[model samples]
Target: MGWLDGYVALVTGGASGIGRAVVKRFIAEGCTGVGVMVRSAEQAQGLQDEFGDKVLTLMGDVRSPADNQAAVEATVARFGKLDTLVGNAGVWDFFAKLEKMPIEKVAESFDEIFGVNVKGYVLAAHAAAPNLRASGGSMIFTLSNSAFYAGGGGPLYVASKHAGVGLIKQLAYEFAPEVRVNGVAPGGTVTPLRGPVSLGKQGKSLSAIPGFEENVANVTPLRFIAQPEDHAGHYVLLASKENSCATTAAIIQSDGGWEIRPLR
Candidate 1:
C-alpha cells in the first residue's frame, strides 16, 4: 500500500514546477484526492485534464485569506477530510541587487516577493489549521536553499524564504499535539519560477536564464541541476505521518548538497 493511501491533500501553486510535481507524487503515493490551488484558469484546466476527478483545482491568489480559506473548505468538502497542506506558492526577485534598484521599486518588489513567498504560506497555514488539526494531519511548505544561505537570490527573495524558517518553527510549536508543520528547501532547480512585476521581471523565469543550468551544476556539490521532480519525494516523506510522525519544524534540504559546495 502507498504511504498516503486514502489521504487527502491541498497544494498551493500546484499547477506547475515543483508544486506540480508534488501533487503528482502525492497521488502516486495513494492520495484519494488532492486540492490544487493555481494562479490561472488555464492551469486549473490542465490539472483537470491530467488528474480528472482525482484533483480539485481552485483558481486564486495564495496571498488572499478568502482564497486560501475557500480552497481548504472546498477540499474538505470534496475529500471528506484534509490530511496534508502544501504551501508552495512563491516568486523570485531575479537577483535584483539592493543598490541597483530604484528606491521606489524596492518597496513594491518587497511586497510582491514576501506576499507570495512568506505571507502565502502563513495564509495557507491559517486557513488549513482547523481542518488539519481535526484530521491530525500536517503542513508542508516549499522553501529554498536561499532560506539558509546567501547568493541564492536578491535580498528580497532570500529574506522572504528565510522568514519561512521562522514561520514553520512557530507554527509547529503552536500546532503541536494535534498537527505538525514542516518544510522542504530545494536549491537551484529548473522551474518556471518567475520574478516580481515591480521589477519588470514578471515575465522572466528562473530556468530561462541563459547558462543558469550550467552555472547551478558547476556550483552545486552534486554537479547537476535539479528538476522539479527531484524534490517531490521530500514532500512525501514529510506528509506521511506514518513515516514522519516524529518529525516537525524540520526542513529537508534537497539542493544538490549545497552544504558541501566548495568555497569560492
Candidate 2:
C-alpha cells in the first residue's frame, strides 16, 4: 500500500516545478485527492489534464490571506479532510547583490521575494492549521540550501529561506503533539523557479538561464544537477504519519552535499 493511502493534501504552487513533482509522487503513493494552488488558468488546466478528478486546481496568489484560506477550504470540501499542506511557492532574487540595485528597487524586490517565500508559508500554515490539527497531519515547506549557508541566492532570497527555518521551528513548537512542521532544503534543482518582478525578471526562469546546469554541477559537491523528482520523495516522507511521525521542527537537507562543499 502507498504511504499516503487515502490522504488528502493541499499544495501551493502545485502546478509547476518541485510542487508539481510532489503532487505527482503523492498520487502515485495513493493520495485520495490533492488541491493545487496555481496562478493561471493554464496551470489549472494542465493539472486537470494530467491528474483528472483526483486533483483539484485552484487559481490564487499565494501572498493573499483570502486565497490561502480559500484553497484550504476547498481542499477539505472536496476531499472530506486535509492531511498535509505543502507550501512550495517562492520567488528568487537572481543573485542581485544588495549594492547593485537602487535602494528603492531593492526594497521592492525584498518585499516580493519575502512575500512569496516567507509570508506565503506562514499564511498557508495558518490557513491549514485547523484541518491539519484535526487529522494530526503535518506541514512541509520547501526550503533551499541557502537557508543554512550563503551563495544560493542574493541576500534577499537567502534571508527569506533562513526565515523559513525559524518559521518551521516555531510552528512545530506551537503545534506539538499533533500537527508536525518540517522542511526540505534542496539545492540547484532544474526547476522553473522564477525571479521577482521588482528586478524585471518576472519572465525569466532559473532553468532557462544559459550555462545554468553546467554552472550548478561545477560548484555543487555532487557534481550533478538535480531534477524536481529527486526531491519529491522527501515531501512524501514528511507527510507520512507512519514514516516521519517523530520528525518535527526538523529540515531534511536534500542539497547533494552542499554543506560539505570545498572550502578552497
Best by lDDT: 2
lDDT string, candidate 1, 121-188, tens digits: 99999999999999999999999999999999999999999999999999999999899999999999
**Structural RMSD, model 2:** 0.6
Distance from true location, Cα of 231 in model 2, Å? 0.4
lDDT of each: 0.95, 0.95
lDDT of 2 by residue, 1-264 (tens): 999999999999999999999999999999999999999999999999999999999999999999999999999999999999999999988899999999999889989999999999999999999999999999999999999999989999999999999999999999998999999999999989999889999999999999999999998889999999999999999999999988999999998899889997
- After superposition, candidate 1 runs with Cα above 4 Å error: none
Query: CA shift at 3, candidate 2, in angstroms?
Result: 0.6
What is the TM-score of candidate 1? 0.99
**Candidate 2 residue pairs in clash (backbone atoms < 3 Å):** none
Alpha-carbon shift of residue 119 in model 2 (angstroms): 0.6
